[model samples]
Target: MSNNSNTALGILAGAAIGALAGILFAPDKGSNTRRKIAEQAAATQESLKENALDLKERVSETVAVQKENLGTRVENLVSDVSYKTEDVITTLEAKLKELKAKNKQLQKS
Candidate 1:
């Protein structure tokens, strides 16, 4: 599990323990205690939903940034390879020309 998951679980456990302690120590009647517990649960649910949405957005943004970085790296690598290939071709052409000139001179002699 992720750190976020662990944090969320800890929050929920603490809330539950707090609610139980409140119900046990309060002087209120059982019906009122139940109502308060229900209210607390509803609030906690809403807060958890908001936190989950925030986490999702953060993960999405991180993925987008990483994807853009990978694309830039790939483009740079391709450009480097293209320049190297052109250099190799030019070098081979020069060597071929030198060989042809030597052959022509030998034939004339």
Candidate 2:
């Protein structure tokens, strides 16, 4: 299973065990004990739900930040490549023009 799933399961199991132990060891009467256990379970459920929502929000935010960073990096790389290509093209054109001029001079001689 995924790490997140395992972690959630562990949390649930621990909560269950703790709740059971508390109920088993309490000196209160049956009705009171049952009510307390119910309350604890409800509270645990709410807490778990809230924590899961928070985690989901954090993950979404992290993903968005990573995507933005990746886009910026890619744009920079493209700009650098374009600049180098233009420089190479300009150098090649200059060499070709010089060679053509020298060939013409040789033909006239």
Candidate 3:
């Protein structure tokens, strides 16, 4: 979960830094350089926004998948427990019947 977000953040930071360095080092008139810097900033901001949204979507998808898996596991466990309980009840009933028959035979004797 954190891993994906971390990678994206690192990439975005690196790109922003590299772009800034390139723009600063280029030879140009002051006004033109400032304009270029503003444009680059706006572009970087948009890219960051997009990456953030993508990260959110990926996290949501991962959570949904895990939730579904958890639900399935719980259902399976409940079904298994229900079957085992039935078997235990059947066994106990048979034992009770045997005890009753033995008691009757002893009373007659």
- Superposed model 3: Cα runs more than 4 Å off: none
How large an RMSD does model 1 have?
2.4
Clashes of each: 0, 0, 0
- lDDT (0 to 1) per candidate: 0.87, 0.87, 0.91
Of candidates 3 and 1, the better by TM-score: 3
Ten-residue region with minimum lDDT total, candidate 2:
1-10
- Judge candidate 3 against the unseen true structure and give its global Cα lDDT, from 0 to 1: 0.91
Give per-residue CA lDDT, model 2, range 1-109, as digits (tens): 2487669768887988898798879898999988988888888788788877877887889899999999999999999999999999999999999999999999999
Q: Each prediction's TM-score against the native? A: 0.80, 0.78, 0.89
RMSD of each: 2.4, 3.1, 1.5
Candidate 1 — what's its lDDT?
A: 0.87
| 18: Cα error in model 3, Å | 1.2
Error of 2 at 41 (Å): 1.2
Instruction: Give the TM-score comparing model 1 with the true structure, all chains together.
Output: 0.80
